[model samples]
Target: MRTRVWDKMIHLPVKYFDEVKTGEMSSRLANDTTQVKNLIANSIPQAFTSILLLVGSIVFML
Candidate 1:
């Protein structure tokens, strides 16, 4: 990704998947991917569930 950003400045050809899974790759993906998964799994469901309950309450009052 960094190389792609600076591709114009450097003349070396770039290729992906060269370091698909290694120490740096695992470190980068482990924390970020877990956080992303938690956000989607827990926060999103809780938000939608709360909204549904709120709408149900309003409809019941009406």
Candidate 2:
């Protein structure tokens, strides 16, 4: 979640800030949250059902 990412951003060491800029962090936070949401909502369930469907179809055919 973005909240968790924001909490992590808040806890970063000062040395980390020396190399990475605020804009880059912001963009990454946005991207990370999007990836997480997609994985949870779409990717995992789709994979699970696709495997079940494939097995069911093969079993029914046999």
Candidate 3:
């Protein structure tokens, strides 16, 4: 994903880089990737567990 993001940024217009600082762009890339990693690592399993619990509860109730 970081590679993809870097590829996209590489193709962007020079005008964009002129306006945004390189440090800021790198920081944003790092932060965004970390957030995505955290969401996948933490949120996905929790959601799957919740769904399984709900299905189990409904099955037992019926």
Candidate 4:
């Protein structure tokens, strides 16, 4: 998704580029990807690990 956004920005017309600043595009791409990376790297794996541990403990206790 971030790459797609970058490709779109890269192919945009000169008028669009003139109006938009480089820092804004760079920040947008960086932040959006960072947010996605944090979620995938942190939240998703944590949730899966918690679920696995809970299930394993329950089965072992039974």
Q: Which candidate is the best by TM-score?
A: 2
Ranking by lDDT: 3, 2, 4, 1
User: Ten-residue segment with the worst summed lDDT in candidate 4?
Assistant: 1-10
* Whole-model lDDT values for every prediction: 0.65, 0.92, 0.93, 0.90
Number of the candidate with higher TM-score, 1 or 2: 2
Output the better candidate (2/3) by lDDT: 3
Every candidate's CA RMSD: 8.4, 1.2, 1.4, 3.4
Which candidate comes out best when scored by lDDT? 3
Q: On TM-score, who's better, 3 or 4?
A: 3
TM-score of each: 0.55, 0.84, 0.81, 0.58
| Candidate 4 wrong stretches, greater than 4 Å | 8-26
Candidate 3 residue-wise lDDT, 1-62, digit = tens: 88888899999999999999989999878999889989999999999999999999999999
Give RMSD (Å) of candidate 1 vs. truth.
8.4
**Model 3 ranges with Cα > 4 A deviation:** none
- With a 3 Å backbone cut-off (N, CA, C), the pairs that clash in candidate 2 are none
Which residue pairs clash within candidate 4?
none
Please identify which of the two predictions, 2 or 3, would achieve the higher TM-score against the true structure: 2
Q: Write the per-residue lDDT of candidate 4 for residues 23-60, one digit (tens) a residue.
A: 98789899988899899999999999999999999999
Question: What lDDT would candidate 4 get against the real structure?
Answer: 0.90
